[model samples]
Target: MSTFEDLAELHIAAEKLLMVPAADEWLLRGSDRRLDEAKFRKVMVDLLSAVNRSVGITGFVELVRQVEATADPVTGKVSPAAGAVVLLALEQRIDDSVLEERISPIMVVLSRAALRSMNAERELIGLEPLAVLQKAVIPNEEILFREMFPELAVSVDGYMVTAVGSHAQAITPVLVNAANPASPMAIGPLQRQLRSQVADLTVKRATMIARTETARVYGETAKETQRTNGITRSRLATAGDPCPICMEEAARGFLSIDELKPIPLHPNCRCDWIPDVENWLPPMPEVVQA
Candidate 1:
């Protein structure tokens, strides 16, 4: 199973890969004399599309592997039927609905920031700031993942999966200097802020994907253990020194598999549950009478 640290590292790597181009574009557009509403919109759309594509391709592949590794052994044998079922369940659980719920608002904030940054750039160039327009269309999660990783396959009995990661977070609120008109707005500050926000968003999306996949894998693993090995309970384990809340929760001891919930008492949670299997062998029979 991929450790939480491993997952985080993957997110960081992928974010960096995508951020290079994003930063370049933001800088290029900031200096353009012809920058207008239409051009600004185009840049926002292009950035958003790149984010979706990078996360879908990089995050999804890692997530699928983590889930698959937990549910099935890596014995170098392919099981298309089983793999298909697993893929379907994961797709259903972590589909567009899930992505939209977590990422749509962030994207909105990003689009707005992008527009604001453009305006700041224009102001620095002795031009009036353009009014912000309606938000750009957020990329579709289904299309992103499907285009990147359309199918789940196995080769030589091992699942084929790719790995990637990077880091980012939410945008800080934009603070304007409304006290003076024609005061040169600093494009540098705005660009830096946008860059950080984009990086933050990348990390957030990747963490979310990992959390969902881990939960699904835990649930399925528990079910399988119970069915095949008569395991009925699971114990919670923390990856390192757990937080006060997780430590308190862990003190509760083992619980029935049905009663147990996946750990990550909060975001960036590094806890997991270990199953306890009961001995299923029958007792020896008493000696027969002569």
Candidate 2:
């Protein structure tokens, strides 16, 4: 089994590789570019605005806010995926709108990594174990990183286990002195505050992108496939009971006992479990915000 340190190293490497182009783009922002650059840059900004507005639900919105607070002001590093996508469009130098053209690739890389990782884990452990891991690991980040830095081939394997401890410490809020919405007269101040926060998010995005790409480029090989042909020798093992978190019956024929991997029994979950499983284990619990 892979260690968390091993996975963290890979993540760091991936980030570094993707960072170069992102940093370069930031440096070249006001420099010469054909009409193409101007057009796409506008599109990129629009897409980013849309992404912020539609970033999951309330929790995710708050998460973005927190990320922005700590992110570098100059780089706008709140979410690396944004930078990766922009870099991708810039590289193509395509005249098309960056958002329409780039969102798919970003989504594709994220989805593929997720499915492939789950499939591999399913074959190695049991379908239940894999499902639990899927709830835990979240391959989207790795995929986003790799796609932004295609030259750096990344695969999602042990990122979940490594991400758990870090995630615990990573949830600090990005404080913003948001203007009082009730005071309509403060509109200008509110806009300025929002702009600052948005800038922070941009930097965070760039940093994550760099880490993911670097890891993919110079990291250890991902498991080719835990099983052959995607066919498990045994049926997906089940718990024969309802999952505590979802309250849905655990599908029959999956692996894992109830106590060790109880709630949030699927992969990429937001819930908690007591004794976390190895590489693809569920999280311990969310910290209570003060």
Candidate 3:
């Protein structure tokens, strides 16, 4: 359990110490992957060339064909590009497990502090301190990854399409210039596109997952501790620039312990829970829900 002030502090620390930094790391790692732009461009070009005999035929005909793969409805042929993207992204992908590992350091510190908080509260209330902190179990990631890879492929395939269309417009000479390792043309825009999309979409998804999981950990841990001590209510604190939905949730002061976890109204929510403390909050002015 935490005071509202304590919850605010936790929320701030998680953002500064965990989410933004992790996003930057993921963006950079997922984009260049430690390779220089020229080298990375060459690598992608080579992969494309291998797939479709050469960059010329590949970028123009092959990419268009793949995009229009289901054009023949009766036969219903699968998109080859989709299949390729799935395999490539899977071969070098970061799923929930990787994200968990990335955020675990901060999570561990936060969870320990929470455990201590629960213990202190119990002692104050003349109850026994918890013997052990409950550990959150890692689910079967292989099955999860199997479900996720195709979704990632959908995005990566789009990025490939972007590379084909941007700057070069799938023309042979321009693409060949891009394929050249020294003084590459058209690759810079493609590289920027890859980095931009991954940073914007993938990083956002990862950040959402991170925050949601962290809130789950907080909620579950607090729920158990509160149940043990016969406490029944909690509060959610809004941090950063919150949406109207969040304002509404926050306005419902000292809600039931069941909703103790931060339930994000949308992705990248910055709301967090205070511990199961009763009637401590003054009434908040209600906001009209949309």
TM-score of each: 0.33, 0.25, 0.38
Tens-digit per-residue lDDT, 1-290, candidate 3: 11212222333323322221124444533432222223333434333333333233334433334334333343333344544443343323223333233232333333333444444445444566644432312333223222323332232233343332221221322233334444444656745553453334323333332244334443454566566556777677787888898888889888777665445455556676555443433224469999
Per-residue lDDT tens digits for candidate 2, residues 59-144, read 33343444444455553343465333323432233233433444444333333333333344343334333343344235454354
Tens digits of per-residue lDDT, candidate 1, 1-290, equal: 23223333233222221221134555655433233333433433443455445454334333344334333232322245534443454344333433333333333333333334434433432345543322223444223322222221011001101111121112112212211123423657655655666555545544432233333333353345344444567777765667887788788898787777654466556566655534434224469999
Per-candidate clashes come to 22, 44, 0
- lDDT, candidate 3, equals 0.41
Q: Model 1, residue 66: displacement in angstroms? A: 46
The global C-alpha lDDT for each of the candidates, from Candidate 1 onward, is 0.39, 0.34, 0.41
Best by TM-score: 3
Ranked by TM-score from best down, the candidates are 3, 1, 2
Error of 3 at 12 (Å): 11
Number of clashing residue pairs, candidate 1: 22
Candidate no. 2 TM-score: 0.25
Question: lDDT of model 1 at residue 174?
Answer: 20
